[model samples]
Target: MEIIRINERPQQVTPRGVKARAVLDVPYINIMNLTLAPGDEVPSHTTPVDVLFHIIEGEGSVTVGPETAKVSAGEIVVSPAGIPHALAANAGTHFSVLVIKTPNPKNMAKSG
Candidate 1:
């Protein structure tokens, strides 16, 4: 078993609008801690791996495929591989998100 401390991980800029910390990355899964402040946006992008997002705090708008929804704390959203997805945080709001990527493709390279 492995354990990770979210606060201890260093943040990395992802997609120009969000900061993320890699929590745990195994052969079959990758977990990250994400934070987006007000006016911050995660640009639309797709990955080969399925992703699940758990909103730990605050509220935001999420665009998944052709649908957009307002998500709040405690909400969860899942996006399948190859679908486009993005997230926008409301002004003055701060949100923490947990992103879980599973069954990562064998061809993808892991970050150093």
Candidate 2:
């Protein structure tokens, strides 16, 4: 068995410019903790694997495909594979979220 303490991970800037910490990365799945400061945004992007976003702190706007909604802590959002999705922090609020990607994209491509 393995254990991970989310708060203990070092947050770093992701390639997309958001602060993120990779919590888990394995063949089957990947998990990350992301923080978006006020005014920060993650541009829409499509993934090869399905994704779930669990809001951990603050409020933000989440866009999945053509639908967009204002989300807050304790809420969750799903973005299916190949669909564009994005997240943005409210004008003066910080947003923290747990990002989970299933069937690791790399592994999925290998199995195809």
Candidate 3:
């Protein structure tokens, strides 16, 4: 059995947000610890793999497709493939998001 620790992976920063510790990855699924600090946002983009984001801590807003909703700790949202989505953190908010991506599609790419 392979054990992956969430705190072991180095944090990476993009123009949009930060990703830390890819906890699990396999042929069919991938999981990661995602964070968007206050005033930070993941720009509107679409991916080929279906994604589910579970807010583990703090408050934020997520725009999925054409809809936007306030999100708080314990809330979860799923974005289907090809749907445009973005996430923004409220002032003073530090959110911990657990992302689950399914299918492990070979064509998965971040929209430029």
- Please report, in order, the local distance difference test score of every candidate based on alpha carbons: 0.84, 0.94, 0.81
Candidate 1: residue 18 Cα off by (Å) = 2.0
Please write out the lDDT profile of model 1 over residues 1-112, one tens digit for every residue: 7667789899888866579998887788888888998878888888887888889888898888999999999999999998999888888899788888887554365542
Task: List model 2 lDDT by residue over 12-101, tens digit each.
Answer: 999999999989989999999999999899999999989999999999999999999999999999999999999999989999999999
Comparing 1 and 2 on TM-score, the stronger one: 2
Candidate 2 total steric clashes: 0
Off by over 4 Å in 1: 105-112
RMSD of 1: 2.9
Q: How much does each candidate deviate from the true structure in C-alpha RMSD?
A: 2.9, 1.3, 3.4
TM-scores for all predictions: 0.87, 0.93, 0.83
The top-ranked prediction according to lDDT is 2
Off by over 4 Å in 2: 109-112
Per-residue alpha-carbon lDDT of candidate 3 for residues 1-112, written as tens digits (9 for 90 to 100): 8766666777787555475667677777888788888877778898787989899889998888999999999999999988998888888988788878896654244322
Lowest lDDT 10-residue stretch of candidate 2: 103-112
TM-score of 1: 0.87
User: Which order, best to worst by TM-score?
Assistant: 2, 1, 3
**lDDT of the structure predicted as candidate 2:** 0.94
Return the lDDT, model 2, position 107.
83
**lDDT, model 3, position 77:** 95
